[model samples]
Target: MAAIALSVSTVKPLGDRVFIKVSESEEKTTGGIFLPDSAKEKPQVGEIVAVGPGKRHDNGTIHTIDVAIGDKVLYSKYAGTDIKLGTEEYVLLSEKDILAIVS
Candidate 1:
């Protein structure tokens, strides 16, 4: 029998954060107005792709994060650490930076 792969590549995050590839929103208005690429609004919500174990507090205790991979989350528009993978952009931020999880 041929073996089948069931898992994908995993990227582990360091410290108390995770890396996420933000999904791009539409660049056109409902009325058929085409907005330039530079005029697109940044999204405040995204899916979690990779996550850190947890963060250590000032008192030395580890505070585990609540968000996990594949979860949709809301965050601040200007928050998170931005990085580039190939031609795409991603964000690395702590779970604390996440505002809420979309049900």
Candidate 2:
């Protein structure tokens, strides 16, 4: 799908899901030639723009997610569902798919 660059404020994730703004892949090589879309590698790292409240438990308490909004995270290569709002690209994935906080 074509990329959409929308304001991130419009999204809200629920039930341990997160809204991540995926990092852009390389645009040019050392020779300064721009890479085609087919040559660009999908980025595995992204910044958390929005987060869910947390996963609710059977006991009625909500367990917090490890990552917070604004955190840069590494996730499974094929984890999230890709989405576009306006002109920005985003990924919607469950907390379990996040491998680590980039720090």
Candidate 2 colliding pairs:
4-87, 4-88, 5-87, 5-88, 6-88
Give the CA lDDT, 0 to 100, for residue 52 in model 1.
81
Poorest 10 consecutive residues by lDDT, candidate 1: 3-12
Candidate lDDT (C-alpha), each: 0.79, 0.91
How far off is residue 47 in model 1, in Å?
1.0
lDDT of 2 by residue, 12-103 (tens): 89999999999988899889999999998889999999999999999999999999989999999999899877666799999999999997
lDDT of 1 by residue, 4-97 (tens): 4422244578778877778777779999999998889887778888888799889989888888889988888888887766666678887778
**Shift of residue 72 alpha carbon in model 1, Å:** 0.9
Worst 10 residues of 2 by lDDT: 3-12
